[model samples]
Target: MTPELLLLSADRVGVLVFALSGGIAAVRNDMDLFGVIVLAFLPAVGGGTLRDLILDAPVFWLEDTVSLWLALLGGLLAFFFTRFLEDFKPLRWADAVGLALFAVTGAAKAWGMGHGFIIIAIMGVMTASAGGLIRDVVANRDPLLLKEDIYATAALAGAAVYAGLVYAGLDERIAFGLGMLAAFILRALAIVFKLSLPRARP
Candidate 1:
């Protein structure tokens, strides 16, 4: 496969994983199927959609319907395979992978749009966190942005790492790989070790 196609595939995989997470959250909250689907769609596409809108770029999923269908398929798979996954709990891993992939894609897209490094970092955070924000809102839970979790911080860290690599004249492929790896590794560590950023006292 072409390098561009491979990158696109990675991004799509992230979308699927995040979409499944949304659907799983819905099921755990006892939401109906429609609610589940909506949650899945939002978490999968929300960040990308927001980034595209902000950039005044064509919506990413509008040009290709594969993303939408993938989100649907992910939700369905999560719904039907819930019992099996419940035994081992795959959502954490899925979420880590998705966050890493989406953060890289988001920053790349922003850079492509001629945004500066800081703006690209913001886009990366938006792209990675939008889905979870939408899911939490739909499920009537406070989004991580409103809480103490290190969610967006993780995304920002990944984006900053990518920008640093690029600034250092690293190849795009290597930069993307390292940045994505950083996000996944950091997030997985956080989940596994219960590492969280400090919360400020009021």
Candidate 2:
């Protein structure tokens, strides 16, 4: 597949997972139906919206209504299926998956735009975290970006890896796979082992 087609397909997958994560968060927080919908919608599109705006590209959901429908579908699924997911840490795992996917897509978009490595990586982190940040704030939870949770760090690493691979002229699929694996594994390790970065002392 062409790089554009690859990114487009992967990007929608990221959207669905992110929306699912948001919906799960809302259900966990005991939100009402409308609240749940709002939560699901925002995180699904927030980061991508920001990235597209910054890049002067068309806003994704605006250009593609399928993304919006996916958000709604995710919210409905969470509303109906929270009980089934209770045993699993749905929020964290879904978030991790979303984080990895978005990081790759974001960095890829910046790279496609011919941005330098730093900008590419920065966009990746922004795309990976902004929606979750919005979710956290609205849900009255701590923002992962502000915590020593290693969340944004994982995204940064993933973005860096993808960008580096592309620059090295590796195949796009390989670059995406390695980059996503880097982010998801790091986040999974943090989730499983309670790993964290150093916190500042008062």
lDDT of 2 by residue, 52-166 (tens): 9999999977878998998898788778886875565665676687789898889989998999999999899989888889998999987766886788889998999999999
lDDT of 1 by residue, 57-95 (tens): 899899878999999987887778766755656766777
What are the candidates' C-alpha RMSDs?
2.0, 2.9
What overall lDDT goes with each candidate model? 0.83, 0.86
List ranges where model 2 is wrong by over 4 Å. Answer: 1-13, 89-94
Q: What's the alpha carbon RMSD for model 1?
A: 2.0
For model 2, which pairs clash?
none
User: Against the hidden reference, what TM-scores do the models get?
Assistant: 0.90, 0.85
Which candidate should be chosen as best, given lDDT against the real structure?
2
